[model samples]
Target chain A: MGDTFRDEELLADVICRLIGDVRHVAVGAQSPIPATAALLAQARGGGSPYVSLLGSRAHTFFTDGARELFDCAGQGRVDVFFLSGGQIDSEGNINLVSVGDYAHPKARFPGSFGSAYLYYVVPKVILFRTEHSRRTLVPKVDFVSAPGGSPGNVYRSGGPIGLVTNRCLFDFDRARRRFRLASVHPGHGVAEVIDNTGFDFDRPTHVPVTPAPSAETLALLRTTVAPMLAEVYPEFVKRVFNVPAPSP
Target chain B: MPLIAQSLDEALAPIAGGRLLAVPRESSGVAMAATRALIRRGIKRLHLVTLPTSSLQADLLIGAGCIETLETSAVSLGEFGPAPRFVAAILSGAIKMRDATCPALHAQLQAAEKGVPFMPLRGLLGSDVLAHRPDWKTIDNPFGNNDPIVLLPALTPDVALFHAPMADRAGNVFIGTQRELVVMAHAAQRTIVTVEKIHDGDLLRDPRLAAGTLAGFYVEAIAVSPRGAWPLPLPDHYGIDAAHMAEYARLAATPEGFAQYLDRYVYEKRAA
Candidate 1:
């Protein structure tokens, strides 16, 4: 508690590494972490893995308008995308629709945005949820906004590749249709993750700690990435990084 | 001759009760002032269709008891938290929800725009969303053996209502890069637009803005409402009024609070 915790920056670094060597990563609205990671990747890779942030004029490259983003994804131009939900299960089913019956839900979350389509079209759909607690990571989602994997006969080219939470990271095994615990974050243990997680996942015999962000990465994030993110998510940058809001 | 309304009320009058009214996403110029005007006029029983998603506008309408059936991918006051009124109404079984995905809504509207009966789209094949939607159907591709896909029925709304950055005297509204609005205008039988301001010259005359302009031929009515999308951002023009949105989210959490909010902000308008 002495020094300010850079949890968001650390998570962003982890996400940046997970992005790998992709051509284009398109981040949807309301996803600041993934957007930061995409931008970080761009900065680290010398302008590689183009980032197309929805709802950003400088970041997006769509001339045909909002529909163009969908068209591009349909044509397989978008490689990596981000999706999250109110509840995520062991099998990677996400629920952004409702918490109870479809007719009369006990809790109604914002309806599924593009998960139905993006979860299938984007090659690498990284599911990110900041809170990885029992309530959020459930045994099974009440509503399947999008399934992690589809039957072999079904035409699905995209699904969950990995899930990043505040506690840890889990790599999705498409064939097994289960999440395998990759690593727990610093100051967090496997037991803590297991205790907090509502869903069951396979764990390695010896779990390792998620690597802390390097000094260079932290510096770059504070300087370069923060400003770039400010262009799109000014409030997030201000609240998270203490960056001044850019003048309109 | 285009149908240009003299006032905001006149522009919204054609959107009769229980009409399937299509509106743009929250990011693209939300007609907030027009929305308040609609609420003040007691517009009821609207089948509200948010192109892909919505925020305050949808929640306000739902809270005001104006929406009968809502078809959209999602509706939330982004960053502000969950849409309280939408959640309250849904929990109470007050409104019918035709749950949909983002691309599905856009694809259906495009199908209507192209004058087609239905449009085939990828995905939703294995999702439970398809299971609940009895209206949607899946079929094996006629050309390819054993290839299946989801076909969405065309969504031709009765009226396309939205706010634009500007509109010319000829009724052409300049939407800039928000192209989804163009699709909405084309798919709906009638298009009613509220603009922030009116352009002096014909919008079509400027070749640069022409491509981004929605020609007056598809427009049924237009009204000039400066700061039409107030409390909401107009995409590339201004940012969202976060304080006001936060206040709405806070007030809409409870039914009584929501009514009081409507009373202060919507019902009994104080002198501006």
Candidate 2:
């Protein structure tokens, strides 16, 4: 890989493509990649689909406070949203509550922030976890903050459509209740993903390498997305793009 | 007589010890200066609720031994990193943690606002969050056929304490789109506010600001404390003091360091 862009930029490009032509995209807390993709989509899509980034002073349209995000998703207005877990099972169960037991045992992660609701309401809930290992991607999550799929009678309009990890992308099949290997990132192979992933997933005989970021996408990301992201994630912008945040 | 308190101490006087106090999210005006004041007072055994999530305020209170029980969805330092004191307390079983999902807290608060017994919410049906929460009950939807859903009991806090951009002489606060604060104020028995400044006229008189105004009827007391949400961003007003927060996250990582932090920044006032 040349010094053109980092792995995060490539991942953002894939996410931008996956976001394709959506009316509205919402990026949650602690997600710089998804936020980049959402902004990239907006810049490329001629601002057709709006992007609402949580914790940004200028980007968000909510006048009602934090709960408005929940209210909008509940009303089915939010088209795409991003979520990740400390532990994600093959079944798509996300555990952000804790790593061990409910009462108390081991690790304690940030509690679920609207995942239980957003997973059910948003049309496309993309699961993005940068770390793709057996420890992070387990056979079963110790605590399920939100289940991947629900019973037939359950009124769920949205759920995990795809899982984007450092190694590969896995498309979730709601009916099958399992993830199918979509594509592997560049320089990484099936064997690496297989070695790292704890849970079982279906894959084709020949898996393709995840596409690199296009020249145009890279340009927009560096010129437009980087500056926009500086407000919310200054450290990420500095580390990835080597761009200093604009002075307030 | 005006409801404005002469000093911060008088404003926070109603918060007596061991009461359920509701607060807003971290990004949405967090009342950090007020939190420092509470720490200075050495208030104890308070049940604190961070509407959906919190950052510095929770960490500071927990570090200072002010909070007995913390009811919130998540507590993180945002860009700084995981809340060290919060992590330490949870792991050591130092605080009573009522872990909950974000919407559940909002729904429960909404229930209290509506004076309803409970609110039925989607999700959490097969979740461990539901399993651990004995207060949350799953019942078959009376209207639907064999559809099971979880009902969250109303959590009516005793006091709603938060900071805002501005308040009027009438004591109406302008929260401007942070609707959960409205719900919190309506649900809690008493509402206390610390604002960056107080507007001259009645906030309700201006139609543009009226929708965002919380009437004086709901507000019990008000204190003017500029930069009240320092170290945390007050939406649409100022960005976060990242350096301060980073310093906090660094110093508060250890118990002794946290004590030193309290001594330097919290307990010991700088000479003017």
Q: TM-score per candidate, in order?
A: 0.97, 0.97
TM-score of candidate 1 versus the correct structure, residues matched by position: 0.97
Write the residue-wise lDDT of candidate 2 on B1-272 in tens digits.
23787777789888878999999887778888778888888899999998989888899999899889999888998778899898888888889998788889999999999999999988777777777789999889999997888899999999999989999888989998788889999989999999999899889998899998888889999999888888777877888887788899999999999999999887786211
Looking at model 1, residue B81 earns an lDDT score of 86
Model 2: runs farther than 4 Å from truth? A1-3, A246-248, B270-272
* Clash list (residue pairs), candidate 2: A63-B177, A64-B177, A64-B178, A64-B179, A65-B177, A65-B178
Q: DockQ of each model against the real complex?
A: 0.75, 0.68
Fraction of real interface contacts that model 2 preserves:
0.66
Q: How many clashes in candidate 1?
A: 0
Best by DockQ: 1
Interface RMSD of 1: 1.4
The residue-by-residue lDDT of candidate 2 on A96-201, one tens digit each, is 8887766675888878888877898898999999999999999999988889998887878899999998889999999998999999998899999999999999
